[model samples]
Target: MTTGDAVRNRLGLGRLLPLGVATDGAWLTEEAAVLVLRTAVQRLPAVTLGRVRVSLADPAEAAAPTVPPPPSALPPGALRIEADFTAPADRPLPTVASELRELLWSTATHGLDLVIEETDLGVSGLSDAPAGPAGHPREKDMTAARPPGGRPAQPQGPAALAASAAPGVAHLASTLGDPVHLASDHIRVEVATAAGHRPLAVVGAVRESVRGALGNDGRPVVVLVTAVGTAEQPAEG
Candidate 1:
């Protein structure tokens, strides 16, 4: 019998989903993806977002990911956000849907820097409150979060430390033992990131840091993002 973790990993419902492409990619957990999108949608007047999710837009695509995602983690490819929401009572449904579609698109693409191909919203109910002016999502702060500087690390102790010390890394999320997995051919690092930082870039930086610590070996380095912390205040630009 398959364990729950295996099922969750395969489905990747609440796990990390691809933020960019499979070859050079990063990930944002589905939970965090939903929170970011839902927060953006909540700004829309009279709209109540619920059950937001992110997933591969084309599930049939056969692009196997290079980075091995954690158990209960997402695979690779272009992603989409699917949401259930409460429609404003006074507005025409079609107009409201169109407005929402654009908001989600902009929020996912511009705000979160996600490779979002589609924004699909379904009306679960109608809000009884009167409609008001539409609200836009808060723009993500693009200011760089500097990585911790120090002497170059070596071997496992420093490799893990270097990766953990990398920018946007909140913590290491390895399931058991060390977060740095040294296989016969490659290395894998799992991390939880801070919100507001771009996921793709963060992962790339992490891979670089880890690789550098490992003597810049020819072997490929895989970085998997397991979680993303929520931004406390929306730093609208």
Candidate 2:
């Protein structure tokens, strides 16, 4: 059956009499339920059912601006964009991390190499336990806690990672903290760059390329420019 029909049938609202049920303020008919489902489904964009990817790259030196420039003076390559944070996992912690890994793999732009590095989870969640053996009660109840299973639970086929990641991909894009536009399923990042083959210029080019590839509409997109390098490095002037 069609999706709408399926929804209607499931709700038991397919084609009964509306008025019969409504004498005392009758209930909706099966047909009305089907219609409602159809309308609701139709309202969602087609892109919502499929995966969309956005790419990001570090900004080139010329693109890194110490001071803001006039809109007219801005070059096209100043925006470094990445589609990292598309969605946040509804589940907490380890599950979220696992979901993030899947999302990164699934939503990565085709032809780009992407990998998830093991991040330092830090001591925040750690706990002290009684110094004891395997079955000791003092052992923090590890039974209730577990890390997200490794890559195996990822979406499962060749692009399983990407597929699993698709649900939460928007979260990755949010980290960029810049204005972005989404059209259809594509995302666009706006940026400015400078002339010449300097480090800043190269960075800007990278930024622009990512912005172009990751452009999306109807979804959140992240545009990150390499505002500044590591703390030890001097600020661009």
Candidate 3:
């Protein structure tokens, strides 16, 4: 490893070029933020992280001059954090998602000192378990601006459909222990298994849950079984 590699590993902040002038000094890297986010999500119950993606607003967007000027020409650390996770079916999905969102939002805002523009939670699967308490799940209301075409714009974001899928499936099978990756309308799930568990069965279950949460919108959902461990030693998410 060279000096550049070491610096890049420690502070994954990318090159800063403003009007062809390169700026010096290290900023927070996406990897650093992801580490913080993953650790935080792991601490939550039934919330296993599959994947984490972070997007920072363009610095040029803030550089534009306006009346009275924006809040300091210094680039603001605006962040949009998205994650794919699996939770036990027994636990309320909305509640789990809400807690995770608050946890990440606080971690980004207070711990990392970054501005959280949006934190989208994508539930990739549920661990298999017994039936949950009987009750109709609360409906989520999403309003969108209608375009000139007159068709109401559809709701976007992973959190939009979590509630509907919570009660349908029992807890997800534990074998699908790996993390998930989701962005826009795409979902990629990584499943881990043991010698006794059937990988295909687990993947099918996860796919069903994903379909339930996302609906049959024709979006692509990819599930990959990445690891198989012995019964004594299980794979990690």
Candidate 4:
């Protein structure tokens, strides 16, 4: 299905708001945060935002809210906001790709640089058994000639099985083996400035864009963003 249809089918957000922006040391109410996350995921089928939990790093500086309010209950003024869009663990990866495409389009409109880090979609483990006893019962003579295992004598170890099984095993290994459970499609965006950027607004825009792109079959998309200059630096070698 198209992006819009997918978002509508998967998530049911009616009216979306414009982009929301926030900065460090800001105070965003819980309700507003959820709204942003909900809207974004609704649009991006590949993205599935789960339960959101907000906390104040410094209770003394900024006290925590006893009961989090809905998106509408967000208090005026900004504080550093960290919004996490938790993806569905069970959904397939292709669906996520469609949603991410939409998110990128939206962020582009606002002159933001969007980057996606895809999770590794690889097979972790595998087990296979030889085809159970190939011939029918009447083939007693052939069976008798075979080993006690009642199956063809397949070779064991790399030297014996390399020529026969290498190609299949290589293909399977490349496709399914990933040690790190990285997201197949991880997305990140960087807005030039946090001035006009509201967390809720950016997320909402992303959501709407994804929904518009992926329609009914939109997959779960995961997105994260930061200001242009605030990105964390890697450790020095």
C-alpha displacement of 215 in model 1, angstroms?
A: 0.9
The sequence of per-residue lDDT tens digits that candidate 2 reaches over residues 1-237 is: 665445434533342211111111111122222222122222211101112122122224223323222121222221111222222223344553354344333321111111212212211232132222222222222222221111122122222222223321211111112223334543323221111112233333433444444442223322222111111212222
**What digit string (tens of lDDT, one per residue) describes model 3 on residues 1-237?**
655445434433222111101121112334434654555454565456777776655555443321111111224345567889887788788887888889888766654445677888898999764433332221220111111111122223442233113222212111112234454655544333333333334445556666677666654554433232222211222
- Cα lDDT tens digits for candidate 1, 99-216: 8899888777755556788788899999787766655432331121222111122335867888988998777764322577777777777676776666666788898898888798
- TM-scores of the models, in the order given: 0.74, 0.16, 0.40, 0.21
> Highest TM-score: which candidate?
1
Candidate 1: stretches off by over 4 Å: 1-15, 72-74, 131-156, 174-178, 229-237
Compared with the true structure, model 2 gives a TM-score of: 0.16
Give lDDT tens digits, candidate 4, residues 57-156: 2334432322221122222222222333433344444454444434433432222221112211222222231213222222222222221101122333
lDDT of each: 0.66, 0.25, 0.44, 0.28
How should the candidates be ordered by lDDT, best one leading? 1, 3, 4, 2
Clashing pairs in 3: 50-179, 50-180, 126-172, 127-171, 127-172, 128-171, 128-172, 128-173, 129-171
Once superposed on the true structure, which residue ranges of model 2 sit more than 4 Å away at CA?
1-181, 184-186, 189-203, 211-227, 234-237
lDDT for predicted candidate 3 compared with the true structure: 0.44
Count of steric clashes across candidates, in order: 1, 52, 9, 54
The true-versus-predicted C-alpha distance at residue 22 of model 4, in Å, is 13
lDDT at 104, model 1:
87
